[model samples]
Target: MKLSEVISIVDGALITANADLDMDISSACGADLMSDVLTHARSGAVLLTGLTNPQVVRTAEMAEIVAIVFVRGKRPPLETILLAEEKGIPLVTTKSTMFKACGCLFQAGMNSCDV
Candidate 1:
């Protein structure tokens, strides 16, 4: 699914890269540890996490993640959002827990390699 499609399906807001709503999201990776994300996330993947630190954005950038979904009602810091804007990374906040968010997207046809 495309990034915009995921946002539409999950009711996610664009925290950054509003212009990049059309970017492709071929997969997803859910983890709280930035290290795991950096090691395993594929290109153009959406990262789901509850960590709200700037390091999360940095890890996503390094791994080339397509988008980020903050679960459990978490939100990244303003500086992190600004950096994401500069890097053109799409970020979203959801009330759903990490497991539910990932499950919802998966049930809606997203996958770790679903496409």
Candidate 2:
């Protein structure tokens, strides 16, 4: 699915400046643990997480995640946002819980990252 479509499906708002709105998101991974993200998330997947730390951005960079959706309306701090901007990773926030957001994306035909 396209980034724009994923955002729409999850009712997310983009918070980063350098996003490719049309970028293709090959899969989704919902996890709060950075270790799980690094271990299970596939490249080009959009990470749906509740973490608002700068470390989340760093992990996304290392894992080659296309974007991050902060669940439960959680927004990252300025430092985290800046790091994501620096890495060219888009950041989004949604009012849905992690489970709900993941479910919405799954229902919309977005595949989950293979475990």
Candidate 3:
């Protein structure tokens, strides 16, 4: 699925203005634990999480995630956003809980990175 479609699926707002909205994301991983994300998330996957810190951005970068969706209407700090922007990762915020957001994306045909 495209990043734009993911945004629509989760009813999220894209906070990364300069990032590519048309990026193709084949899978997603929803986790708040950076360690779990690092262990299981696939490259080019979208990371859905409630944690909004520089560490999350760093983890996404290290994992080569395509984008990030901050669940429960949570927004990252300016420093984190700046880091994401510098890394060229799209950032989104949704009012849905982590489970709901993941479900919506799954219903829209995006698979989980559960290999």
lDDT of predicted model 3: 0.94
Q: Pick the candidate with the highest lDDT.
A: 2
RMSD of each: 2.0, 0.7, 0.6
Task: Return the candidate ranking by lDDT, descending.
Answer: 2, 3, 1
Global fold similarity of model 2 (TM-score): 0.98
Per-residue lDDT of model 3, residues 1-115, tens digit only:
9999999999999997697878899899999999999999999999999999999999999998989999999989999899999999989999999999999999988999998
Q: For model 2, where is the 10-residue window of minimal lDDT?
A: 12-21
| Model 2 ranges off by over 4 Å | none
lDDT scores in order: 0.83, 0.95, 0.94
- What is the number of residue pairs that collide in model 3? 0
Q: Which stretches of candidate 1 lie over 4 Å from their true place?
A: 113-115
Ranking by TM-score: 3, 2, 1
Residue-level lDDT tens digits of model 2 in 26-56: 9999999999999999999999999999999
Error of 1 at 36 (Å): 0.5
**Runs in model 3 with CA error above 4 Å?**
none
Candidate 3's TM-score: 0.98
